[model samples]
Target chain A: MSAPSLFLTVESEGGAVCLRLAGVLDYDTSDELAARADACIEQGPRAGELHLDCEKLRLCDSTGLSALLMIHRRTTARGITLFLDNPPPFMERMLSVTGTRHLFAPESGKARQSCPDEVRETTD
Target chain B: MAPPPGIPVTRTGERQASGVWSTAPHPVLESAAGGVLTEVNPAASRLLRGARPGVRLADAAPAWLARADQDLRDRIVNGSGDTDGGASGWIGARSFEAHPSRSGNGNVVWWLVEDTDRRRAEEALATERERTAFLTEASHVLLSSLNTDRCVSATARLASEYLAEAAVVVSPARGGKLPLAHAVGGQDVVRSLVAADPSQLPGLDEALQGFPPVASRWIDPAALPAWMIPEGYTGTITSVVITPLPGQGVPAGALVLLRSGGQFTENEQIFARLFAARAGAALSAAHLYAEQSAITHTLMQDLLPPRLHRVNGVEFAGGYRPAAAQERVGGDFFDVHHAGSDGDDSSLVVLGDVCGKGLEAAVLTGKIRNTLQALVPMADDHQRMLGLLNGALLNSHHTRFATMVLASVRRTDHVVRLRLTSAGHPVPLVVRADGRVDEVGTHGTLIGALPDIESRTAETVLRPGETCLLYTDGFTEARGGPLGDEMFGEERLKRALSECADMPAEAVVERIQMLAAQWVRGGGHDDMAVVAITAPRTNHLSAVDGHTRGRYTA
Candidate 1:
């Protein structure tokens, strides 16, 4: 069977960067996501926030989670707040299961309202 | 006088007699039947060097032309001169075709047409074809093997056979010594490592460093060092061409071509460079492959799972398969470490899966195994051990995490007591002698992801003929089936383990692996690992006779 592919699109608005991740994010595609995140970070200092839109993300394997953690480490080093805009249920469970939800906490109230189920699931 | 029927008479009427015979562009001569020169045209005198009316044909013309005139006269005297006389010979450096016509008085008029240009062109075409064929064959031979030594030898042999009298392929210096493969003519290649300096020759060092070659004329053959020429070569080296064998970024080597005769033409030198390019690429590939394989082999030797055996009276068996079939080791790993000398009777068995796959994951797996090995002294407290491991991971630079299950097994009386704990990993499954399967109640966050980790340890006892199985998520997450996308879920694994209730530890592990492999036939998979801890059934009949089958006396 053909493997699933990952696509990334980056946009800068109001001094903030938003990287949209779609399709599978497993071993084969994790490096690409990490590279894109590095490229976004290399675009000089932004409005202290980097948002990752995961609304269309289909799957995130352990390696994919590791890439997100790496990105988190990079942004934290630069004092940039990172947020997961709209994580799916599986990603939320993965974060909760690994106990890394606090590391990538979404700061915006709109993001929190969009992922209310994710917050409730993590709390449970 | 009418010209011979086969000959073209270009000049007409008044000038036809003398003009056609004298003013012709081709060299013409008239010789008598007695081998004497009767008349010589101006063209003939200019082309033949020494031609006069009284001189003998043999003294004025080349031997082949003179012999052809004598043979024609003999044929005419024998009344059989029906065939036209034609002969080809070289006068000085120029070649010519001699055509003869006989007159009524038996004097033969000879016409010589120069064909030097046509002959040289044919010779050039033949040489070009030969070089093309040699290059095609050289490519095939050079690429036949990915062995560095074999590639070096092939390059030397091909250059000697076609381009020069002898050749030497000198590899990049290693450990202050250069490896050389030398060949002469069609003889076997000889390889040796010599400590000779490359700077002895003007361009040798630069060529070895991947610089463009110096012109062949600039390198004097008298400057060749003793090591540069192959042994037993008797001829004096008249010319040498040193060309760099360029590789991927770095230089692979240098090719030294030696000739005892004339210097190489510009075309020949260009062809030699082309040949070196092909040889360099093949040699570089071979070197790269050797280096990579050596590295992978060394790393795999350390990371591959150990062979499980009976440890501390508890039967232990493990099976592991990497994600890719061609790969040897991946993220999933298992280890059985005998209990430390801390008065603990239990042996620690750890099964874990690091994030990601292939060599990167295997490296992390190695680190985790080493850390756990060092922490075996604290096997009694599972939660404390996990917390320490979590801190170690968090302090390190790697952001990747791992899921793992640790089981401390102790055999007592007729049962095996076990303390099992899971850190964001699949819980251990217990299979009873009555074909009942139960999942241990233990869960926690994965290691390396968070600072503070929480884990609950569950204690259990396995009676005789019961087994406890700890596996990685790769077992339940294997995606395959008739549809090729269905997961081999936990339910399926539990059912498969239920059928192995009274089996030996090795048999149980093998059965689970077989079922999973069948479910994911030829499909992509994550790395899967399983370790089984079984309580051995007492063999009551083993003391009476060694041949009889033992009946469980639990």
Candidate 2:
């Protein structure tokens, strides 16, 4: 009857920061995501790219999408590039359907590392 | 004399009878058979005034003691043993118990023992128990209704019945006027609002301000205002106690008690305060609930979606279901704005879903709808209007974005012409007369996201018996089925739309909503909304009367 609870973990390797989101991101859990994103942005100047790893994300509703947009605004204001790393099938479809995939697309001349086969299938 | 019938002739008794009667602590009296006192000890002579030898018992002592003495003598003469217990009665201010015994001279000696302290204590305990029961019942009755006026009336009635002959419950002053509920013993409660000043009576102003009550002895009952007394209360006000009805944080009101007889004892005053405490809490809760519901009702009126109907000669219908059944408004919203009175036949129909659900999302939708309404003059240029809307949203502080579909519809002859555009929203689907469904190709980035937005508006036409369907993502994304996790998907919506060919505008909207609702099957969902625009089928025969839109024959 209720969605799976959301879990977020922050990991920094070398100069890049990765915020991994798991479980459900709906109306109830989207605010927490926004809060976590704000906290990460508060940490002083770091890497050029802030990656949101969505490999384990099961669902993202409209609210969750709004939270992602908020995070993009924060990262952009700080002169950091926000990236959608390892987006699952559903997440990729949501991004493309909402026409936000270009905002999080990989930079030019930087070959994306290990794009999911399902992403290629959907895009085709 | 054999110690007169049942009287014991013990050694101690004989000794007391011989000489100790003069120094006995309790009162002792000897009476003859005709109710005349023959002799009296020193204690008896001191206890009963006007008592001496040969005096009648009835003239010296209380009537109850004289009658008790006569009954005992009659029972003895009748050869029946005295089976009744000794009589107890108040003598002056103190209580006494009288036990009868026979002395050596064949006369009855009555011994009286004082038990005033014990009797007073028992009486106090019984009064306390009765007051406790009354307070418990008062709490139950006062809390039964959340109506503010009802709680006030109940408080007045309860105080009248238990505390005093009449009571008045004065609500907190507003605009120099106070609301009052007055109740009298064995009478119905009357409510009124009076402009009289509370400070007219001593301690009333302080009580209204939630201060501890001034003692009843300090307040003169003659100072009470005429409005404070209930009509038909014939008794003169002898004593009055004014106490504050303490509420959450502030005082709810004050209670005024009126009595025609004795002053309220310290204990009764304390008990009145206790009853006021319960009544105040109930009244405060009821007042808070009334205020909250009134505020919610006013706000919800603006956020609720309007019922769609035919606009500008084109049939328009809409259906919406919030994610939560208990909620009336949510993130999804739709509106149909008829063109200005400039003779233009086109109307702008807007449907959108804001991020999230419930009241927070509904607030955002309200902002978007207002912005769109202001931009209705630019309805001809869909791209320009969306660009302005997008700018407005980005300029604001909202962290959210919305996906919206806009359709400009106008009927020409038997066909409906439509200019459809999607702003990061689902494209409109057209259901043909023969049940063939087609998706209008329109695409754009969602509003309030990127500064430089791009959209492609598509033009289409609907023939008679054809309909255009616009919906939110909540339709295609609803997750429920035999598996309970599968998205309803665009393919399923298309298939469902294909079956609704040739149906009326309202019927088409209803069918789509029903199918999506069935798919969700009471599972968790997002806010779903749908709007249908159709060209009415021509019915020349029915149009002859011209009173109504002809019924569809299909």
Candidate 3:
């Protein structure tokens, strides 16, 4: 049998907490991350910022992407900031392809390359 | 420990009392020098049935005095004066502690205090603890496995370990016949228990109606099924507990626990019911997962690319690997469809990746696949077919788009012609016979985004040992490096492809995939696909060929 597919590590940096994700993020393991995100949202007042560290993330399926979107919605509703840091190229491609890249703020200047905020809309 | 509140001790530190001794609530028996009961108090008369004047103390309660010597009373009063913290023994069904008191004239009075209530309370506590431990063990075993068969076996093992000498789990088969999933302990005993149909047993049908577990009366081994009562089987089967595994709305299975002689306790029956409930819940979950996987598998089969068949001059091998954890078919797919009949070889091979991974992308993938399959007749003109596919994608209201590579492979004797087009996808690679690699720089606009799609077709010819590879971006976008943030990159892929010098088409594809999978190392990578078309290498090449004689020299 395959081992548990997702591993999450939470670290508090400055006033923000970063959830570093490793292994797979798919249908079976996405719910756990969603619950963790919800818990962070519940502590919104004290949790200055919510950041998902994708540096160690190996893969993210549509369900994993949807979970990120859900967390974005929750944080936005609670008037908190959410960041997606150092996403791999394929994950960036998925967000850009699906036209949902604006939901999360990327750390560093990585967002300036490949897919800029401009040229996002296509000519009819 | 001190004496009772009103008891007095003499200067010698021995317990001495006057009226308190005779009026004590505990039973008192006095024996003279001859070991005969000189007097029996009212409590003593009620405590021991044979307690009376002129009766021997040992005769009144033989179990209490069995270890007592004739001088036991004398030793308790004079030698130790305490009877070794009082001798404890059972008189009939009651437990008693005998304390001896001497009256200075060599007369010893024995005080019998009943201890049955304390012993019964301790036994009850011990039984409760055992039940809790068993329940915890059963829970761990039942919930550990998602497999239905394993869950069934776990249930039976738990029943045998805690509730019975032998246990069996019987589940209803699709037909009327019943199939046993798991059995523990004596196989013969389990077989004999199965001899009598449980449905015909009295009160069993009602018990299975979501009622409590019911116990069977002592069953004669001779009355069991012939197979159960083997030759020289002398062991007698006493009783069995039948507990139903309640399903969603109906009972899914039954648990049978066997015993040889002892009657089933009420607590044991309750534990059996709880265990059955856990088994039922786990079975229900396993069944649900199986049903869902079946549905997903059917959808996946429909979305998967067809196997590549042999075209006379070319050997084709293609594979699709989905990066989705549980669902194998995501957005990346490839297909090889032959448009020409028998010897006249003309085939259309297309590989594409929808924008995302999952159900939505999978749905889009199916749409693109079906459209390409329908356009095979007109596929001879690669540009026109792609134009039609682009128009079809633009017509959909959703913003979903895909990157694709379309190849038209034609064979004439020893030579094969290829025309390739790309819709904003990565350029295809060609592996030369002498271990050199060339990139076919094909360019195009993204399929669904543009109204008038501009795509350029790249043409190339392959010798006998040459091969062409077409794949999605998942190949180069896989992320794993020394720093762990770098992509696998096109340079690594090119180097890896060059290593498979003289391998066959299938072997070439497998080598590349194996390298990529190793690089990914089970990390999260995008869905990947590769299609290799190799011309079989003969002893000597046909220098004078009928087809186009163009070479791609990187």
Candidate 4:
């Protein structure tokens, strides 16, 4: 079988919505990503939780990442919790290199407790 | 005795006795007793313009010798011990030492002197030579390494050491950290050149604001960093000239050099400025190169896992291809994950395309894949996974989309659940164990179809000897296809899959890439991604012992 296309998946956890992404998220897909994240925030919690699933994600460009940044800003301002999780090695490194790792997936104690297990159970 | 190099050898007898120990290209004079010419070197003859050796030493030397020590005369004339007592002091004179020639005894009192006026001329010559050597080396260093920070730091260090001036390096940090590159100068003066707060030092502030490689001076320390005034310098700074350091883009930071003792001369300051300017360009280029490399490296690493995750029962063979040749690689990728505990032979294989390409698409791809990995365990079925993925993608961002084939293979029961969803993406090709070629087209639109949209699952069994191939549009859309332009279309991919039905995932990817590559001659028209898995349904087992069966589950 051929490999699948990139994906940006989102969900709800605790008081905020969750957004997860897989595959290649780039300029072409960033718009869709931006819309999804916005929907999560506009829907409830005055904020949302962004969980980026990088396991299957293969690539991302600056523009794709910028979308994530936009989502982060939106959610943070509205008191949403962004818990980007399971980032692929590549995504994690990029986030760290660009100094945005903390902004997206803050350490658990930094904000609200991350319900990783809970999110896992729900999403799975 | 041999003379030092460049001192020009001279014979003793040919030496001019008229002046006191004056000789050689650059000389250090040691006064002899009575200045009666107890000894003379030939260098003196050259200095005296070939004056005869028999000329009276005392009268032939500068008349100022009359005021010299009386003991000098006593030691030379009477051979008394006082040779070591001779002292040296500057005279109110410039170049070309002169002496009075008397018609008295050849035992004349001589004079010894060195014109301090020539010191500047000599120093300038030396400085010029050193600067040339330094800049040449700097050029080489700038071109060799692709590290921006190192290049900048190296250039600054070279400037500081070569020019013996305050060389400062500054770059804007992403956060609040006020990270200054570096500053090199005299311990006392360099501190003022480096101020933690811009407001604390007006001179430095002006220098930083002026442009890169710019130099500015504070005639008084009142406007500079506090420590610069510890002793309170007296000498007025001569000049502060800022030669803007060029950054590839916007200025990252500025180099502030403060000269407190002697204001830099016009030529010296110009040279310093030029060096800084060149260094800045080199640093910018190096930074760009480094950034590109880091991105490439990161992309490559991100494309593949550091180590394989062992999925029970089934062997995972997947490969990811990002357009490495492109300026920015695409986000196309694939991954094989342990959807269940290692204790079980249930694995989830996700082969798909992230909507779009380049960095953004890559990010979305990563999110979907990671989310699937976290959620697949609880997903229970391909449909549940699709739902979770859809939900996660919908929440991750706005308007992001993708196409994918998520399959759960259960090795224990030799069963597979395959689902294909396209958010405007091409469908995957499947090859049965018996070489039955089929395309699972349009199971649904690609991912990110809509926040609430759910894709139907494609129910298919991976019988023994069956292999499935998942990939992105870059495959069927391979360039060189002008409508009917010989594109490596779906037909070609299906044919290739049918041919390599038994090959492992990695091998299948390579084979297809090779075929496509040969067809394209050299380049990949678009980013191509592939995933292939072969599960031996019925065991051709030796029945020899206990071997774990491979299993995959969704």
Candidate 5:
């Protein structure tokens, strides 16, 4: 009833667009934001520079995880990198256990150094 | 006799100094009684021009040298062990103090200082390593578990590895000969000793029967199978301990550990037993979860609308998503039923949202769903059909209230008479071909909330391209939205309908769902039941559409 409660913000930093997600990301919002991300990459962004800011994002469940997987796949296929910046620990653990840590690869490489067995597949 | 006191920080920094600390050669003071220089560390040796290990404190520095530096004499009179280990007071290289033990039978005094730096670093490293190992094991199990068995076996292996147990066996609590559920290592010299005649394994069946695994001392080595005692594994094996699982009715099963030298301590037995109990419980839960998911899935697939009811002129698209979250099962139903034998006269469209979830909710859903399906064909108006469903819900006290909307769409040429009956359901959003949206506000008290439900019916007209949408609270009260703070009021829904009015029935539902998503974010906060239907514009399309029912989307 109230203009779909979610609001979107896009910020540009050093030639990269940092998409800040301000609300819950589940089944209801998956398609719209996913669509938005897809369009952004289509408009041309370098790999590893297209970052998603989820500092305020409140929830991330299995459905949201699946949606993220979809975006990850779509972005990688186009040679564009997708970064999840400072996601809440809940999402971080979900991604870790699901072995999608490679998607949100920590810049410092701390956890990654502990796990050398991360299987890499060039799958889009 | 009280031991003479001046102690050194450590042997590492030996140099010349006075007062038992030195960076340079200075003076060494003595007690007033004999001018005794009782404490001398290696640094004092430097004052003696490198006095070797056997050099006594008095020999390293004579009292005659102390009169030169009176501060050295004062320290000789005072003895305290509080100085930090590494940092010794830097006087001259004349002396280093003798260090005394902090606890019992204090015998050795040396120039060595305590190393808190190294000790703290080691402890911190150990703590971090422990956490990393735990996370590693958790991730391994979480990502890989596919079925209940794999879940237990994998996690059991992880637990066994974590607990560093000799064995971890997973066995069905139900009938199974192997008392061992899973095993790692034990007295058996063989690797992965599976199928061990069940009788050969120590404390096997005995533990399953509630007795603990026979302690190592109680078990006679001669009694074991010849294969269990291989030549090389003799001493490394400490003892064998068997622990019983907690839950009852488990087929005779227990965890058996093998140690060669020592018997299991009381605490170890308690821990082994407790860990096994939790493992079994978790296993049972995982099994139940898998079973329930399979059944709920199969049942929903088996029953779908056989065909959409055919009335002259309309298009329709409907979607249903069962409460997908593990905690709940939503029982929401919708159907377009026609009582008339001919294609033109009348049809009833019913949609309802049942309260609660799980096997019980599913059962009630099936009952109400089937009962209404049977009752609709006999009813002339929507109200009569709904009253039948309400009676069925009232007959059972298993669940609280359910909201339902029943609509009768009748057409005899241009005028399509729509009679709506509601038992506490969302008012259907009506959209015109001109993109004008309005709420059909056809709502009534929710059924089963109270004994006597006051069902209400409203009449409306469906001209050429006008469509009406019926949906459950799941859509409006999505997780991220303000549903919990306030009801997802009908006003907002009506506005959405008016904004996207000209869309087809399916698109309108999809868009409304999208709008709900936009309002609440991505969460399917509750179970959603949605339907959108347009009165067919032509007799031909209506006739063709009548043969098909609602579609199921993944």
Candidate 6:
């Protein structure tokens, strides 16, 4: 009966679009991330970079991970750089568990990258 | 045009030349006082040329000519009377307007005027009416079925029958390939069309741009792609109109209409679009239905129990039914695990219900099932397995939790040993051969609710012809009774089990499900799950270690 435990917010900063993902990122809420990612890519992302801030993300399930992979596929296909900024420990664990840890660029020190690199790593 | 072979027209033997005869626009046929045809204008000659021209007016003109003749006679009788009475009718395929006038010599001048535009307008109105009726029938047929293939086939058939002689419906398949979902036409025509790539079909790509229907001529068959003209296809197509089919969020497909003769008219194009719209809606519904079924299948994969296989002389059976209101898999889950791969003597079984419903609870159920499977190495140590599972749940960091009954059964030739562990789940029931049911297993706190969880294990031995059952709270919490508010509580379930004591393991599960369904009276209920293990009535083989059943009992 309660509202979904997950929420997402999108903003533009320094010529880059930042997607702040909060709360649980499980099966019920994964589609939101996918839709937002698709919109950002289609509308040119305000810049050449998309930053996913996952500091408040509490959980991620298998379906949620699949959605993330879809977002990654869309971003790279459009030549837009994607950054995983400040992912919580649980998100990191999920990424490794699903063997999709290589899709997102590693966080650089404490500063989030608005536009990182042209060369990104991906796996089949 | 020449006149017909009969009814010769001989100009009246009176004055044949008049100044007005040279320039009159409409045909003028004059008759003498005795009703004999007189002077015939050049226009009149051209108008009546297709029929018997030299005949009497009554024979040459339509039925309205008699009325005109009567008016002419009256005019001749009354000098001051005006007899230019106009009569309109059809001669052959052309419509005509005839006027009768009295001349100074008492002769009648019949002026005939053709109306081609009116005839064209009437024909167009009839075509539109037929098209509207055809479109209505097409919509009804398209909407009758939710099967995607059937809808596509019907759309193609209707398009060919009403819109064109040949038709094809194209939709995007996996990998961005556009496949022809349906094609309707003669064998030769369909073969040529089937050879063509849907994406490369003329006008189809343009229509897929979300524009209106696009009409184009198949300019050159020889210049088309090799696949477009199959070797055995001998027919030729001249015109094609592709109309895009709109879907829920995107274009569902494209409808291609082909003609062997003239180009499609403007009205035909419009009708094709309207027909495509209906076909689009039906296709969209079909796609959504397929998607929903796929999601349900995936959800049921986890919501339903694992394959119930007989293990180590012990038979296991389980059944699950989701709530009627939910078109999804609920939070209930069950699994039966054999301890070791070889001739393992012990097996572990778990049936649990997560705290919430829908996908969230389903995720938690998956986590529980996986954790239990991983802990099978420690199945011999029932308390250790429970403690490890509890720790794993606490570390999951999610709010969801579950209540489960984990039972490990070890079977000998004559008796079966069970180590039952309860995590806030229902107490395991032992059904004896004499139809006596007793509850076993200690009550424990719910799993994943808190850290440092308190769990317990109860040990019991099942003699031959005895059975044990484990279930989730869905069984007892199901509502509907004589009062309509009463829950089918544990007592009722216990009584139901007592009646099934003489049945096999599968029948026991079936009887309980029947009782629960009847208690709910076909009303709403939570997801229910039951797993029962029965020991055979007689042991046909000796026990392991070359020992008989008496050693274990003693």
- The best candidate in terms of lDDT: 1
Candidate 6: TM-score of chain A is: 0.82
The residue-by-residue lDDT of candidate 5 on B405-429, one tens digit each, is 8877776555456777666666776
* TM-scores for every predicted model: 0.74, 0.75, 0.69, 0.48, 0.50, 0.60
Instruction: Give the per-residue lDDT digits (tens) of candidate 3, residues B245-274.
Output: 887777767776766777677667777888
DockQ of 3: 0.08
Task: Please tell me which model should have the higher DockQ, number 5 or number 6.
Answer: 6
- Give each candidate's interface RMSD in Å: 2.0, 1.3, 6.9, 12.3, 17.0, 13.0
- Which candidate comes out best when scored by TM-score? 2
Highest DockQ model number: 2
TM-score of chain A of 3: 0.81
C-alpha lDDT score of every prediction, in listed order: 0.84, 0.83, 0.70, 0.56, 0.55, 0.70
DockQ of each: 0.39, 0.52, 0.08, 0.02, 0.01, 0.02
For model 4, residues B519-549, the per-residue Cα lDDT tens digits are 5655556667776656654453424221444
Error of 4 at B392 (Å): 3.6
- The per-residue C-alpha lDDT of model 5 at residue A26 equals 60
Pairs that collide in candidate 3 are A58-B524, A59-B524
lDDT of 1 by residue, A31-124 (tens): 8889888877877446777888898899899989889988988888888888898889878877765656778865466653433232111100
Say which prediction, candidate 2 or candidate 4, comes out ahead on DockQ: 2
Worst 10 residues of 4 chain B by lDDT: B98-107
DockQ of 6: 0.02
Alpha-carbon shift of residue A80 in model 4 (angstroms): 35
In CAPRI terms, model 5 is classed as incorrect
